[model samples]
Target: MTTTLPEAPPAEPGLKAGLKNRHLSMIAIGGVIGAGLFVGSGSGIATAGPGILISYALVGVLVVLVMRMLGEMAAANPTSGSFSAYADRALGRWAGFTIGWLYWFFWVVVLAVEATAGAKILAGWIPAVPQWGWALIVMVVLTASNLVSVSSYGEFEFWFAGIKVVAIAAFIVIGGLAIFGLLPGSDHPASGFSNLTAHGGFLPNGPGAILTGVLMVVFSFMGSEIVTLAAGESADPQGAVTKATNSVIWRIAVFYLGSILIVVSLLRWDDPAILKDGSYVAALSSIGIPHAAQIMNAIVLTSVLSCLNSGLYTASRMAFSLGRRSDAPAAFGRTTDRGVPRSAILASVVFGFVAVAFNYLWPDTVFQFLLNSSGAIALFVWLVICFSQLKMRRIIEREAPEKLVVRMWLYPYLTWATVALITFVLAYMLTDTADGGGRDQVVLSTLVAVGVVVVAVVRQRLGRGAAHDAVTSSKA
Candidate 1:
């Protein structure tokens, strides 16, 4: 009798490979440029002085390394689970289960946070609507966008990213001219890099401030890796990963670090405007731009909405992937005929709604706790990606080198260096104050990291037990 191989399993629902190259490319562009850089960087600059540029550059380099690792693995084996699936294949089941849940948790928390922030701005524009009502409206709109199709999410992001790109480019051009004393009515007289050193000097706070600044800057880069996750669903996964990984770095540096350079160069490090307003627009207003705050508010509102939309989509898809992998309840794996994971989307959105309620009811207690706990997971995810890529590269080289389209530079060396640098950042976090305040975000973050490690270990054992049982039963 002839032996025949079994057929492959059917693809999971709401998990179709429909995203195109353009979607992946734009998603990569949009994911890196979050509202945080626009709204949150002012405080960082205020705290660290002109040296904050170093902070951004340090974090920017780290992001490039991490994204490269992710691209290397994602190009090899594209999947919606992206890093989680790579962790499973390259490391172990526990790695996959832990990281997947952690990522899903991270995004779900982000969904609520972004929605609330976006709603606050929307309410300002349309005061007739209550803040909570605006939150509900934002959630409903993005959820509808996601439920329609992945392409819809892509289209939304393309425009959202386009607006941001155009805005940032204009800001850079105008701001650069002002910094160089070229613009009309420019009073600052070129400043000539003196602001960076004139105050307390570049390292006024010392080299240690850079570490403290990392706590803020690192989080700004959190969403950049989302592109690799979304690319798993693209028509040409390898191609998408290649383009995104190659181009995203310069975009991030120019848009983020470059814009910050302009801001700092135009104003003193200790300007009252930086502290009172806490945004680029505020900084611009301090520099004498009319309608600055309103312009910034509008830009930030768009950024918030963009983040909320992406957050919902990321969380649901992660949940859907987890369910398909048997790490989550099977129900979440089910997709609608339209290839949308309706149940998973609903489940994530419900949690987001609860978070919004929590924010409203106990703003101080609940929101603070949520922010602290989820603070360190982004690093955890990056560390896992590094390790996963480390293992995956060797395998790909041995088994299917031809499939390795996008390879990490200085393989194994730079890869390991990235790992060491991440370890150093975590260690540094333990000593550094959160936001330059006495409060210790490091301790809270460390606890979360330890908890995730414990969970990963336990899950690995459980997966092994199941595998062993299956083997024994087959033998019997």
Candidate 2:
């Protein structure tokens, strides 16, 4: 029996299958381990105490479910636009245009965030260069790498993600050993798994704090879907998507939950420096690792650079997808000889540079505004994915049952459960306005999302009118 998968709209004709399986695998592994895990976990731990693990678990489950849904779709009909393209097929052009632009907006803003983060670390090491100089240097170097070829970007990310994976794995292993009192040079008698329960009984701040911690760590999981996007450029899109999807369980368990467990166990939840220097660094230092700060600094830099690289790749690809669909300027759909979307890349980079400028001129105000505005976009994209998959599953089953190789568990039940969970999280985010200052992020992101919705509707309406006029002219 021949199996017919749901067909993706044809590509705009320049992308090549230059990415290898190894590159795709490493991207799937490393995409989820962002600088947020190293740096933001510090804040989450401070907020949720040992209960931060619950926060991680909650968000990890959400991410795993979302990725499964995304994998089912991407594997069925892989495209560079990823969920954006899927949204187009499953829902409507309006859904695709809005979500795609929203996602592009998210990553381009993240490019600035990661660039500035990398710059701070570089400037700390080399005081000779100003911070802005370092930012420019980092951005330009990464931009050049991406512009060269898809393989060049892959190679750079391969090493960048390798460092992060190894670092986190080593931290988990060494810290676990230290927790069990097996590692040498352990001066602190207080370190053990007991640290998890000792400091105010694990749920020190109460279970509700877990939700707060969810808000903290959920965004860290944003890049996990990058693999699905990159799978489009791989030699075997369906295979790559399936492999990455299947491995999501271990990746979340080991990278996020395992590492956080080690951190909380190796040091007291109340460790002051964990908030000051970051949880990973504090864990390393607690284990008597000399130059632990510098080592973790290097790892954070690697994470940041990897994020910047992926951010550029993702934003440009989204733009390119939009252009190909005629939602964006047609030039973005055109690719260079190297199969790179130069115009799309440049356009995204332009916004990134503008963000960098905002960071420089108003780090506290305008830049923070941009940060808050795009803060909730990950949740938005996830929400869109959930809805798209719900409709897409039926379409695919009717159009191509063979592509059901990667199916979401429990069908519509779990699917609806996932949707409810995401909606609850968004509603929870809205109520987080009291004294925590999350209101800005929630409100601004909502406004931006609403604005995008309006634009999408207008665009769709205009498109319909244009089609109507063209058909009438032909008849006349």
Candidate 3:
């Protein structure tokens, strides 16, 4: 009796249940370890000193709560549409239409970013091939993986995420050993707990720097919620979601906070080596790890490829969901005999290809606009998830409480608190006007969100009018 629309996938040509439990497990663990962690965390360290750990912690908690709300809804009624479909039922057509496109917009832009990042690394190793050519090659390869079947995508992710998991775990263990002076070759003067506060105190730049660090690190957590979208294709979506939600804490704690804690402990946050070499590399090198930069670069490239693969898969599924709901072209709704939404995949990647071109041809002007415009979307998606759950919880409890295997702790109170926290983060981003591009991101993303909302509203009204006319004609 829930208000959610029934997704009769078997009754129609629909997505296959292709993701295995192993694939979902790896994704849950490794999704938190993005290329950004390797490629971007140094900037946060420079901005907030050792206090960047606090920034990661705050954002980690935020992601856990958002995933909890998302898990509850998805467990009750699994669908590839994920939050967008829930928004439709709990809020309205307009909410689903708007957020779906926005989320899709986010990942496609991500595809370009990840593709370029991976290509740069590839070109470094194989200097004969230009970066642009490498980008094209990776994009095509990953797109093909997605187009083959969901299982192919899952298999590719399983290994990609696996490599990331191993790299981060190894880094943490090696770095932690060096911090306590247990690492045999690590006689670096900086290795000790004192580095946390002894150098310049933990809050070296003052406590306000934590907020700046949040802006720097917040987007790095963008891919955390991807597991929920992926759960829909698993053998048991509700179970997959439940397990992923329960484990999010340790995943973020170990991979993000634990590794970063080691980095700060192993070396001072203000180390010139950190700013010159990346955080992970700097930490490893301080501990006498040879070829640290090269090792980190390989790990980062793997992370980038993993992100690109998942970005395509996530975006296409969202587009397919939108098409199924009539918020997009029906062609996006069509699937192959293999249950792949081929059109949806192509559409998403085509845009990604164009965005990649923009990065090369017009990076300064057009590509920057695209990047900033999609910047705040992760917050927007989390906000919508929070709102959707507030309504969804009531509907599920009143109708099918039995399906409420996963519940948000403290119900509406925590939900609202999460809402306020997300709003505060957004407000923080809006006000922080400096080199971080916070203000530009908020404004440009808002402009894009407003445009999407207008289209959703007009589309909803027009559909309603058409339905009314059809009913009148039948009556006559």
Candidate 2 deviant stretches above 4 angstroms = 1-8, 434-436
TM-score, candidate number 2: 0.97
Each candidate: RMSD:
3.8, 2.9, 2.1
TM-score for each candidate, following the candidate numbering: 0.92, 0.97, 0.97
Q: In model 2, what is the error at residue 51, expressed in angstroms?
A: 1.1
13 Cα displacement, candidate 3 (Å): 5.0
TM-score winner, 1 or 3: 3
**Cα lDDT of all candidates, in order?**
0.81, 0.90, 0.90
Residue 108 of model 2 has an lDDT of 90
Task: Give the clashing residue pairs of candidate 2, or none.
Answer: none
> What digit string (tens of lDDT, one per residue) describes model 2 on residues 209-310?
999999888989889999988888888999999999999989999999999998888878888999888898888888789999999999999999999999
Deviation of model 1 at 279, angstroms = 4.1
As for lDDT, the candidate ahead, 1 or 3, is 3
- Once fitted onto the true fold, the runs of candidate 1 whose alpha carbons sit more than 4 angstroms away are 1-14, 185-188, 433-476
- Model 3: weakest 10-residue lDDT segment is 4-13
Q: Which segments of model 3 are wrong by more than 4 Å?
A: 1-13
Cα error of candidate 2 at position 196, Å: 1.1
lDDT at 411, model 3: 86
